[model samples]
Target chain A: MAGRKFFGHAEPREIVAFLTGGIFGSGLLVSGMIDTKKVQGWLDFFGAWDPTLAFVLGGAVLPMLFVWRIAEKRKVSVLGTPIPPRPAPKMDPALIAGSLMFGAGWGLAGLCPGPALASFAIGGWGGALFFLSMVSGMIVAPTVAGWLSSRTTS
Target chain B: MIPQDWIWGALGGLMIGGAAAIYLLVNGRIMGASGILGGLVDGTGRDSMVERLAFLFGTLAVPPLLVPLYHSVDTHITTNPGIIIAAGLLVGVGTRLANGCTSGHGVCGISRLAPRGLGSTALYLLGGAVTVFVFRHVLGVI
Candidate 1:
């Protein structure tokens, strides 16, 4: 794997990245984020309305709120690399259009990128089908987004 | 009353937040899943491709190993082929177009009080609810 050539071994950065991802994956599983029914039920707010997801959201957000502040105080990461500064929020057409598209899709399928990946074991071949299609969408999104950007700007 | 799901959900949520916090503090990057994957797939993240790949590897490889700890795991993804493809493509395009997903915009972006994150998350959640309503109530196809 090309990753092995990164500094000829696993650097702390790579290790942390791996750990971060692992922790995330574990969290997704334990938190039921990977459960399609749970997700769909949450989205079914107008229906039976499972309140499970809000807790997950709250759990993730509350801690992250503080993390961001701490990060803001540091010029560089512990690794001594500059943190990518947050971009100013802009509400644009592409965002609006894309958000609608994403939500519609999310509601239809009850899967998103992160859980889509994590749930492969549980979701099986059907999951693979969704993932491949998602990759296709992602590949083409830039061109579509670019078109949206141009239209909005001009 | 909080359901059992809530306890696990919050615990899991905390872990997710902790992961994001670690990534930001150590690697100095926001932990947006779609952005990470999109960057790699769309050829935008070539410089840090190794890191991206490693992070992705964790996301892809780790969860399956942990499933044995659970009593049972079910994703309940729709078996409908058409819905599967359309939803996948939409998520792919939507996240990329919007530059984030739940993790990016919902967790990371909202936490930082970034407008892009908040706005996108709101819209996507709305998107989900509206779609569910249409699919379940109106069209009855989803």
Candidate 2:
């Protein structure tokens, strides 16, 4: 099959991102990261003291390190988009607020976007709740962003 | 440590990875799950609001269709609905505020070697760890 070109410039970065995410998700799956029960067990903090979750993350980190190394060597990404200097957000209130909220949600639902997406594919109640809540969060963001933007503009 | 669970996890990863790749190829966008999700919410990039919603829903719901192959994985989310709702809102807000999520930063951001992405992912991971500690260990939420 002839490969048709898409995206103004298809670059290796895009390929890497796609593979990395898929691999991460696969890693989560193989490691039982998508299972909210296992996730919850890890989150339990008080009960069985399951720490297997960390290993899944640790395993992914190895491959991730390799991918980033390759990415850094190339000046222009396959997309032809010269990766701009990484912008660092000051460790500010917004970061704190967002992180807290995200952690709380994960602790509560035992799912985040990645694992939620994976679990949703496999039919689980936690995934369903996660999908719904995730939307709710998005719906509410614009008003907040607009308000914040206005403050910055003023 | 059931062997089958590991098999399912691996399958889930491949499906998600393939999906991200396809999206990148088609849209020329990173398959940052949060970004795609945030876009679906904001309705600014690529698709219109309705289309975005449909696309987002499809992206999310499509995974469950694989249940037959993986066998249904049982779950027990012990938290109340209110906590779940609140947590979701926070994540959405955080994704937009942070300009990404785990997929966006951990996967796409790192792939691009964006310093911001790396920083953001680190924040996310740290946040996740701390939150879990507080909720279960301190607050004692079962």
Off by over 4 Å in 2: A1-28, A43-48, A75-85, A88-92, A121-126, A146-154, B1-29, B47-66, B69-72, B108-122
Q: Model 1, A13-92: lDDT tens per residue?
A: 88899889989988999999888778888998788899889999999999989988888988789999887787866788
**lDDT score of residue A13 within candidate 1:** 86
Model 1: CA > 4 A from native: A1-3, A6-8
Please give each candidate's TM-score. 0.96, 0.67
RMSD values for the candidates in order, in angstroms, are: 1.4, 6.2
**Candidate 1: clashing pairs of residues:** none
Report, for all candidates in order, the number of backbone clashes.
Answer: 0, 12
The true-structure Cα RMSD of candidate 1 reads 1.4
lDDT of 2 by residue, B1-142 (tens): 5555445544544444444443444434455667766775666654323323333445444444444655444545544766666666777777777667756666556555666666776666666656677766778664
Let me know the DockQ for model 2. 0.28
